[model samples]
Target: MKTLPALGDDARVRLSRQGGFAAIHALSRPREIEFAQCDISQRTRICSVLEGCLTLDSTVSGRGDQRFYQIEVNYRSGGQEDRMVLKVPEDQAPGELVHLWDTGQLL
Candidate 1:
């Protein structure tokens, strides 16, 4: 199974207080953004991006039908999760997924 990657030092990570909640944004490249919203009443960070692309590489990982692509990502919010995962063939381009994931605009 494909797994997600960790957040890199390149991420412009930030946090903001929204009403009774806390929202975090981690942005990078060509205007992509990863966001999370959490309730402030909790003792820990609850909001999370879960999984989203941080970078894209053109190199192919395998050959023919057994092949798959990679997208590096900051998998979880609160600076806890990050990794690389296989790219999923979506209706939109891979960059679009990254944009949606970053901006919290995914449908």
Candidate 2:
């Protein structure tokens, strides 16, 4: 599984060759993890949120005779930048992840 960090307010979207996709969002604090499975034909979409700016990890695998691909997102405070890592099949292209930080002041 590959891991990456979500930077900024932009949402990160990943697509799989088997018609699967995953979206992730990063928060300033640690939060509860939520997951839901679907019965779509050959396609699945999963989402996860991190409450406290921290590492975000995710795993994607094909159901019924499939390999597993992993992803991780690392969020760091004090630094002005975010970090991300990607691990996927050699036959597949790289995925994109976004990172964003809170301004601390609310509107």
TM-score of each: 0.25, 0.20
Error of 1 at 74 (Å): 2.9
Tens-digit lDDT track for model 1 on 21-100? 22223212223233333223211211133233223222343334322222334455665654443343222235434444
What is the per-residue lDDT of model 2 for residues 43-84, given as tens digits with 9 covering 90 to 100? 122233222211332234344443223333334535654445
Instruction: Please estimate how well model 2 matches the true structure, expressed as its whole-model Cα lDDT.
Output: 0.29
What TM-score does candidate 1 reach? 0.25
Q: Local error of candidate 1 at 70, Å? A: 6.5
lDDT of 2 at 92: 40
